[model samples]
Target chain A: METGTVTTANPLNVKAKKESKSKEIARKLLRSWTGVIGFSLIILLLILSIFGEVIAPFDPMDAQLRDRLLPPLTDGHLLGTDQLGRDILSRVIVGARVSVVIGLSTVLLAGLIGTIVGVIAGYYRGWIDIVLMRIVDVQLSFPFILLVLVISAVLGAGLTNIVISLALAGWVIFARVIRSEVLALREKEFITAAIATGVPKLQILVRHILPNIFTPIIILGSLQIGTYIIAEASVSFLGFGVQPPTAAWGNMLDEGKDYIFNSWWLITFPGIAIILTALGVNLFGDWLRDTLDPELKGE
Target chain B: MSDILLEIKDLGIQFNTGKGPIQPIRGVSFSLKSGETLGVVGESGSGKSVTSLAVMGLLPEKKSKIVSGSIHFNDEDITKLSEKQYRKLRGNEMSMIFQEPMTSLNPVFTIGELLSEPLKQHKKMSKKERKEAIINVLKQVGIPRAEQIINEYPHQLSGGMRQRVMISLALLCEPKLLICDEPTTALDVTIQAQILELMKEIKAEKNMSLLFITHDLGVVAEMCDRVVVMYAGEIVEVAEINELFDQPLHPYTQGLIHSRPTNNSRKSALYSIKGQVPRPEEIGIGCTFANRCPHAFEKCLKETPPIFEKGDHLSKCWLQDSKRQAVMK
Candidate 1:
């Protein structure tokens, strides 16, 4: 009925109304305490990742043997120094870049590969479905960490290889979720209507199927970013990720573990940074799932 | 008036199941003239919907195969057309409107987006021209507030409004033939009438041939110039609308007509033909309705009856044989 009155309104007004709807969602998001904290934490991490080198007072890689193992509130070092006397605050600041980059890129690469496999398997079905799903099953049967460790070990250590190995391990979840979504959606009459309308199969997959499955993809991507961040830290701590002498939180933790009994700030700062990033990502993902899920929106 | 827009000859479709291949459609044949509405009346499992899907070239590819027959649309045998060729004709020269309006429109797309698709696919229209055309079609389909409705998603509209949008979608290209598979069965009575009226107005305006598939005999009476009654995947009767209703030759058609509850029969038990329609796999060499036919004889149980023509009316039943009719008289 409101549409009746809005009929006379110009297209610009309609576009404005659409913008307001999203703005309303943003307003609702900020009203919740979890949303506020999670959002702020992510923003803080983003800023740290982008401007870490510029803002860090001391070069993260520079070591001062005389200042080794200094406690918090030392001169020129806010959080103190590591066993190598590297500034803990600067290391933690720069470590955010590695975690965010590895986390975001891994999810992106994994999501792309998985969604294509899923849409193909689901839309075509029969032997194609069986083959792809069996591959997914074989991949999924392995423990998540074991799979990542095995892949990282085989590929050897580096930034790109870690992202690749983690992506290979993480894509199965996305494939499984997206495949099931496509399986359900392909049977809907709208899909048949699209086919009858002469829309090409690829167009149907991209325009119709992909858009419908985007919510799950976004939710899965957000949730997986947290998992990948932790996975990267674990891999890097094992020396299979961003190598030593780098300001990655994982190797920083590895370096500081030796002096943990004497100097607490070394490992404590990096550990807190990893936990905060993961926690923030997970909280934001949960809120996103709740808000975007139409079924849950009734509450 | 005499020009045939579409023709089907002995269309047989088989579905491959785990058990075995079962032929659901067997020797089904019919034709639609350029501006005529042909109603296909049948019950569930009668293969009416399957036949329509075959016509649209939308049948599940790996599962169902067209084992026999040809579908000639506009003088070309569409059954032989490649998928690419079929695409050229589909949603261009011919289009289909499905039964469930609720699920037919993509929920994520706005009405304008849905309508613009067929235009984008088949016609060479610019964005502005397409928008103008979409608004014009929406208005022609009796959708009020067409401009605003175009911006709204499918979920925002009621069932009747969505059905109108679907009609406008089917009409976007001014298709020569429109296949509607029980389009009104899902709507309430009032909405059903409104949709039927809108379709009739559009059909006349466009001079489009309509293949209307429904199990409701009332709809057949109102919308069809000719009717094809299908039972067990085979057409048992084909006749002009008045002739089929007044003198339903096939026992199944008669049973269908008699079973309709009327005020005259308010105090009496409604007449119903006994026995369910045999499934495709259960059909044998004999007449499909032999078990249910009140007038069935030994011959009806032994052999399948061929189509017996009487001027414009055709009936597939042993009872329609001249000798049998004379004996009965």
Candidate 2:
């Protein structure tokens, strides 16, 4: 419905118009200081996750009772040691591996599953829409942590099991978001045109519908990554997520809670990691939403 | 032109709204011969587009139902065909182009990809062959610099160019019939003219039948060989293009032609039709256009009229009845 009068009048200017429009969005995103900081922090966390073990000064699990509860800047421990004398800095850095991996994998799994269901339900409405949406509603209504707790309890504790639990919780969000988008797009003339062309239903879903809805999926996935990471940490803290020795941020916070009045550094460092990662990913997601769809940009 | 390409026999389409069922197209029958262009003209909600969608098998499954109909396309009864069977015929044997060129081509896809889809689906062409064929078709449809424009997306083209791409895409498989539903309704007048010219040329070169649906009588005059004037979903009159324009039958058709603003009528108020098309729910047993018709009588309000054949032309009105004929005689 957007009538680009200038572009339509002079056909030759269309390509240039698109180029400048994208460049303008890119420039605006780059100029936002929060976006830059968020982008940098996310990159830093990714590097740490990939190279954490190589960069850590000491083994994360190595505990020496003799050096237990060491304060900050004691005996070359940059961030000091926990109640078990394991390096706090080493543990947090290595813990990034679990958080980032779980966050990204859960998002990927949820996005794929959700998009397929959403496209099917949205494109072929009536009974399919009713059934799929009702299931989504049921999933959404139940408490997030409650469902995760129950699933993790049944599945037992492990990284993959944790991923599956979170993914199951996560897919509903994507399905709901994408289904609404598909509903609007179904009435668009291009979809009818595609159907008229004799393009198979599956082919139309893949070729026509999926690409158009990819922007929203990417934006939602990026934002959900932060939420899922925090959720993964929460699960791990409850002993239903990653087992203790794996060093997840949630359990690190849990371990530090017992020694909180005494050793503040244990919780302080891991808590910062969650806050910083969440902050960065959230800002970047906001920027992505603005950049992909200009209509969403407040200005 | 003698060969019958498509036939619609007593096509009855009904929609089940929350309130009740409304039969939009009631026992409508028409046919298109090979290489002949048939124009269906009507106002908004006249079921012109719905009829076309019915032919394409693109009607919404849950909302709209073809209650009773048979669509025979090249000897195959498409109404009885399954979705899979329709798929094989679509884009290969018959294709359709819609109004709003900007919205009709997927915005995400480059013109190259959009154009090459039919080839990939129906034709077993390799990548290189497909590219070549796409470029060839684009050029045929009058897209300048087909090589460069092929890589550009729909948002990067003008309305006219996008329409050209649509035409080229529809023509890729050399379909025997092309149904264009108000293909020029969304473009500017000049662009509409260009698109019509392109369609006219392509249609001639391919020797294909065209079912053009539009409300613009001028377009019908320019492009169609025969015109079907419809009111409230029923065909009121059917005649050769020149004959219809010269001696316009059906009060609705006359109203449409007179409403067109001409250069000579700049000082005077543009003529307008009186009442809006009655809603489907309000339409009853009597003639749908009786309230709007300039010459309605006691009988026109009481009973619906059957289509009366007079030589090559057909008109559905009490005036075309046997009693009226007897009185006149």
Clashes of each: 0, 0
TM-score of 1: 0.93
* Whole-model lDDT values for every prediction: 0.91, 0.88
CAPRI docking class of candidate 2: acceptable
- Candidate 1: tens digits of C-alpha lDDT, residues B1-329: 34999999999999999989999999999999999999999889898999999999999989999999999998999999999999988899999999999999998888988998999999999877888899999999899988878878898999999999999999999999999999999999999999999999999999999999999999999999999999999999999999999999998999999999898889999898898889888989899999999889999999999999999899999989998889889
Where model 2 places Cα greater than 4 Å from the true spot, the runs are A1-28, A294-299, B325-329
Number of the top-ranking candidate, with DockQ as the measure: 1
Clashing pairs in 1: none
Output DockQ, candidate 2: 0.46
lDDT of 2 by residue, A1-299 (tens): 22221124346676687789789876987888888888998999999999999999899999988988999899999999998999999999999999999999999998888988898899888798899999999999998888988998999999899999998887999999999999998899998888777789888888898888989999999999999999988888787998878788999998888998988999999999999999999999987887787255435
Report how far off residue B249 is in candidate 2 (Å).
2.3
